[model samples]
Target: MEFEVQVRGRTARRWIMFGMIALGAMFLAIGLVLTGVTASFLSDAKRARGSVVALEWRDDDHGASGKTLEHDTPVAYPVVEFTSADGMPRKFRSSAGSNPPSYQKGDLVEVLYRADSPEDAQVNGFASLWLLPLIFGGVGLGLSGAGTAVAMVRRWRS
Candidate 1:
């Protein structure tokens, strides 16, 4: 009975280790794919100077009870207006936002857009282009390293 219990415990540990490694690999793959996509976009994108025309507000609460708090503030995403390569005016809201607001109305910022789809412009900044990939990749490396360390320790103990 004791031997059976020990075997079961080992099996569970193995499964846990495997799960961590698998999840880490998945995150790493997603990060790599996102990095590639960002690189591709940057390669063919056109740069333009845009002005922050307005701020679009979004609720920060993730579907919690609709109680309003004085300290709670809505995230403000900047809406930028710029002219495309062909001299046509275009507007797009940035994907990233902050609590206190990152940009004010009339603030000029760099914009990147594809000539074919000028309306699908994005703010040209590190946060807009590489933040997600870096986060995912870092998490992936941490998790994977932890799992590998666990496996090594288990083997050393045996």
Candidate 2:
């Protein structure tokens, strides 16, 4: 009471898929390690009334200002400079971002630090988001390996 699949086409394709799986897994592992290192070294350093040293850009003023949440308008966000709990000066910013920060210059903001290393930190609260990509990469790697292994075994028996 079992269903047997009769694979067709090129048998060599199985080995190719197996190779791809191994390669994907390798990339996945590397990505995981990188994200882990980053998460370990630095995190969202939540600071109390953390002072904003500068504003890099202005998102959306809508011609409205004064304690109002930033809107769709384009503004400048200043690069905020602050001292870590360890008394080390740090520059907080959005990654790969050319635009400005949403907050105003000299604005106080919150921060957080990596679980392993508090010296390094990020301005955004979602620093832990780094794990998402890492997790996805790991899954992709594992799936690829599994697929390859299954195919190889099937081909071997065939």
What overall lDDT, based on C-alpha atoms, would model 2 receive against the true structure?
0.58
**Candidate topping TM-score:** 1
Candidate 1 per-residue lDDT over residues 21-114, each given as its tens digit: 8888888888998999999999999999999999999876553667766677799999999999999999999988887888999999999999
TM-scores of all predicted structures? 0.90, 0.46
lDDT of 2 by residue, 9-33 (tens): 3445666676778777877877777
Candidate 2 TM-score versus the reference: 0.46
lDDT of 2 at 143: 69
Best by lDDT: 1
True-vs-predicted CA distance for residue 49, candidate 2, Å? 5.5
Residue 117 lDDT, candidate 1, scale 0-100: 91
Report residue 43 deviation for candidate 2 (angstroms). 9.3
